[model samples]
Each structure stands twice: as structure tokens, then as C-alpha cells.
Target: MGIPLSPRPARVIDLETMRQRQQARKRLIRLAPELDGLEMVYHLPSESDAYYGMPLLAWGLREDGEVVGLVPWMERLTPCQSLEDPEHGHFIGYRDPETEELFEDPPDHKVTELEQAAAYFEYEATEEPTLIQQLPETQGTHALCMDDSGEPWQLKQVFGWRLYSDGAVEALLADERLIDSTPILPGDACLYPGHSRHRVVYFFQRQIANRIRREDPATLEALALMVMPADQEG
Candidate 1:
């Protein structure tokens, strides 16, 4: 008779904690070269902590009591109903295992409760929204960045006088440059779709203004027209 095959043991891993730590470590490693010989301090939230439906890790690069950089990593989470008022709607929050703190930040601003409810139901109602919708859209006023080859680097969405990245429901509070620049309006959408990519390392057009602003999309498109492959020229 054939020997019975033993069932493989299930890998019991805390994925949220693992992801948060990985991102935190990655950010530190990337910035290590920039710190040179200076010792940089990190101020990350205790692990497994959630903030506003996302797992978060905060680190401040400091020396001699002054901060040079602040990096915060937020991980996505599974969808869940709102605890405050279930009849009002449902949402999601990041889950971290290293820490016991849960995020308690507000979810919407300026946008009405009904509007937020609509978004929660239409987009985040299910476990995941359709992939195409999940992809960032380059509509309304935005910050834009382009590579030497003229490809879009990223898009920063603007609402009212405030700007936001696609799917970023709340404004990013840690990036100083983004906070300093004059907020863009909907009419400015065609102006700065991927500009922030030029300043921060590994910046992309689809990313939000988590660091600094760079250039406008129209300018990038013009540059591309002058240098891009003839087949790509429009």
C-alpha cells in the first residue's frame, strides 16, 4: 500500500505586520545612502497599528533635534463596515500585529456624508473595486511628472483648492513640499499631472504628492514631442 501523504502545515503569518515592517525597512534602506555618515533616527508607530483604515508606520529622520525627513508607510486592508454607524456605511482599516493601537482618524472632509456614503457603496462596497476603476484617473487638476523619454511619471488629483492622489481619501500630512505649494483646482488638472516625480526618488505619475512637486504635464508632453520616438508622437 502507498504511504499516506502528510498534509502540509498552514503558514500562519501576520501579513499586515510583515508588510508594514518590510515597507519601513525598505524606506530606511533607501534613505540610508542619503544620510551619509550622519546617524538618522526613525520614529515609527508601534507595529500592527492602524490609522484611518490603513496600517501605518511613521519614521522621522532626525539629527541634533531637527528632522530632515519624515516617512510614513500605510498598508491597505480588507473592507469592513463602519462601527460608528453601520446604517451610514462601511469602510476598511489597516491591521498591524506588532502594535495594539487602532487608527481613529476621520475618513472624509468637505465632501458630504452622503457623497462619502456613495463612494463607500459604489467603489469600496465590495471586497475590491473593479481593476480599471482602481487604476488612477488623470482628470481634474493634477501634478504631473515625466521621464526623459516623456512618459507620465505620476498624477496628483485636485479637489476644490486642495490636491490629493488617486484613491487617497485624506490629504497626506507628512510631505512639507506638497503642503507648501499652492493647492491646485479642478481647472488646473491639465497642468501638473506628473510633476512631483522629479523631486523624490522613485517618484511616479500615478503617485500622490507625498514628497515634492516637480513639473507640469503639458511641458512634459511638449518635451516628448520634441524628443520622443516618431511612432509615439501624436
Candidate 2:
């Protein structure tokens, strides 16, 4: 009698799958599941807030970081909201399909600001460009520091770069009128420069503006980047 050989067993690959597991989380998906391998994140523009167009896209990760359960996602079964009557329901299939009764009721004011803001932003972005009128760069506020030891120079505020919290200088350098260009927050700051560069001779408001003394150490480095330097201008 001869012994028969068996084929290798099939391997079960483990994939961290992220899916909408519950009704509450259907709109707000988990964030950054790929760090743990949850890659099966399904998303679309519609899953986001109906008013603003911000993508509500994220991965739904499990405690163990694997796709193991089904929760409350109705996107596949019930898509699109009904606009037949604002009072009745905004999300169509969420309500009784036949009678148009809602599965849940949301306040009337919830959607107003989200919708209006989205529309306003779209208009500002897509509409015609706004040209900044400015006078000569030399005429604007001049500022500079020769070095760590040199006297800090300062004048009226310029219409060029404004030092932001994130160490960025957003340049809107072509206009006679000076404007405020500071970022609202550290994250809101620009990562790089704009179209133009203005070599400023800045006078420090304070007597000392050293790296250790200044609030934002990167400010000096950021301003230095915009300069062509007398040596590099040629």
C-alpha cells in the first residue's frame, strides 16, 4: 500500500477591514485605521454632512483593529433623502418608504448654517479673481535686522508677508494698500510661499528678538527664506 500526499492547506489572510458598524457611526467614520491595517474603508461624498461638502471620510476600526462585525450602516439599503417636504424628512430612505415617516427626527435649524456656509464658500472660491492693488514695494513699511547684534529696524506695517504661528509668511506682495495676512491659527498657516517675495528691512518692536527671546523661533528663519540675499540677486 502506498501513502497519498495531501495538498497544502489554504491560508487565511488577516486584513484589518473598516466599515460603518453602527447607525450613529454611519456618518462619522473612525479616523486613521490604516495605521493598524484597516484598509477596507468605504466612503462617498454623500456619507458626509448633506449641507457642507466636507468629506466625512474615515476608517472604522475595531478595538482589535479588524473588520469583524456589522453595525448600523443603511447606506447600501437606503440611499438618498427625501425633499418632498422639509418637515417630513431630509434623508429619504431614513423614513417610512411608503408613508414618508422618519426613522428619526432632527431639528429644523441643524441644516441651515451648514448649507448656507457651503454655498458661500463655493461662491468665493469659484467666482472671479480679486486683484490686490498696491503701491511700490519700496514705499511700503520697511523692516530688517542686520544680524543677531545689529539694530532691529521697524516701520509701519507692510502689505507683504505676515509672520504666522506655524512659521509661515503668506505673501500677498502686489498692492499699494497694506492688508492683514496673519493666519488664524498655527495649523491655518501656509506651508510655503506665494507668488512674490519682498525683501523687508524689519525693525523689531522689542529691543531683543533672539531665537530664545522671541515667541516663535521659526519666524526669523521663515523671513530669511523670502530674501534673494544681496549675493543671490545676480
Candidate 3:
């Protein structure tokens, strides 16, 4: 048998919700280990040096499995982190990880339960994703995409490799789609699916938002707020 499954019931809680979410994420990290070294293909539209749309595929996959993604999503904060105490930044500068900048009187940021759940599903900025995914098996399929006529395209060479989690990734896709359209983790490097990191991140974040809205509406609002661009969130 694989890793023992965690119920992760959606009963809803109060303060302990954070602790519960963290526990769920930690447990997932230890469960599945097969996703390591996997690759997903991203197909972004190219219009003379400008990329448009987000079409994701898988690597080495000849297209036979079931497609599960194609949901435009965005999440502002991955690698969920808590805010430093008021004293910590008393007279110091802060660096915006996304922008990679330092600011005096930096805006405040904290890891909410919603963000934690996102990390649970897909870690941000870090290498490993699916640290808390319930499903361990990945298949290949057409899956839903922004602009797909469902026609087989000619797949070229591997242009990108594991570019989603770290930051911006660009890839050249040459059809056949992934093997069974397997489910790739967020961090899995492939082609840059969206035009910009900001847009892609938001799309994924929205994915998490939909999950919350279904399982727990209470989290949906805060999650929507947090997933906004850093400037907007601030």
C-alpha cells in the first residue's frame, strides 16, 4: 500500500484551523515521493517575442491518461510564511520575495490558514509541490486549457524544465501532449504557461480559492484577498 491517507475532514474550526492545516501539509510531505523529478509542459502562445495564453502539458507523456487540469488559477503566496513580530522589523528593511526588493516600513504579510492550504496543495517559490496532495498517481490527457481547439499539435523539444515554482519559466512545446496528461505539481518545471508570472500565479491562486469555496466558504474571501498581486494585497 502507499502512504496512509489523512481524512482532512472539512468540518471547519477556529484558531486551531491554522494548526490543522499545517499538520495536513506536513503529513503530505512525508507520504508521496513519486512526484519527484516529474515534468509538466506549458504551452504559451507566441506572437513575435510576446507570449499569450497558458496551455500546460506533460513531459515524456505520449498522451493517453486522463487530463485533470486546465483550470486557470493564481495564488499570491506560496511557501506560506508568517509575519515577523512588530519588534522584528522595528528599524529594518524588508525584501519583497516576488519583486526581490527591500523596502523601509515594509508591508505586513502573514500565513493565513487559506495560504497554508494552498501550500498544502502546491508549495510556492520552493522546489517541492504536492507536499500535501491527496492523489499520488498522475495521468496524461488533453485537460481544459485557455485556448485549445482539441487538435493535436506538433510538439517540439524540451524548452523549459521545472520553472513554475521558482519564478518565471519559458518553454517551447511540440505536441503529442503529456503521457496520459498526467497531473503535474505546481513546482514542476515546464514551459511558462501564462504570459506573466503574476497572471499565472493568480490563476493558480484562484484554483485554491475555488477549492476553499467548495469545502469551506469562510476561507474563500480571505484567500481571494491574499492571492491578489502584492501591490493590491498591500
Best by TM-score: 3
- Candidate 2 residues 1-234, lDDT tens each? 988989899987544333423322333111121121111122244445442111111222222322221111211111122122242223322222234343332223323433443335332222443321111112122233232223342222223333222212233222224323553222232321232333333332222234324546576565456333522542
lDDT, each prediction? 0.29, 0.28, 0.29
- Alpha-carbon shift of residue 225 in model 1 (angstroms): 32
Worst 10 residues of 2 by lDDT: 69-78
The window of 10 residues in a row where model 3 has the poorest summed lDDT is 58-67
Q: What does candidate 1 score in Cα RMSD to the true structure?
A: 17.9
Q: What is the lDDT of residue 186 in candidate 3?
A: 37
Angstrom error of the Cα, residue 200, model 3: value is 4.9
Give Cα distance to truth, residue 152, candidate 3, Å: 27
Model 3: C-alpha RMSD to truth?
23.0
Error at 110, model 1, angstroms: 9.4
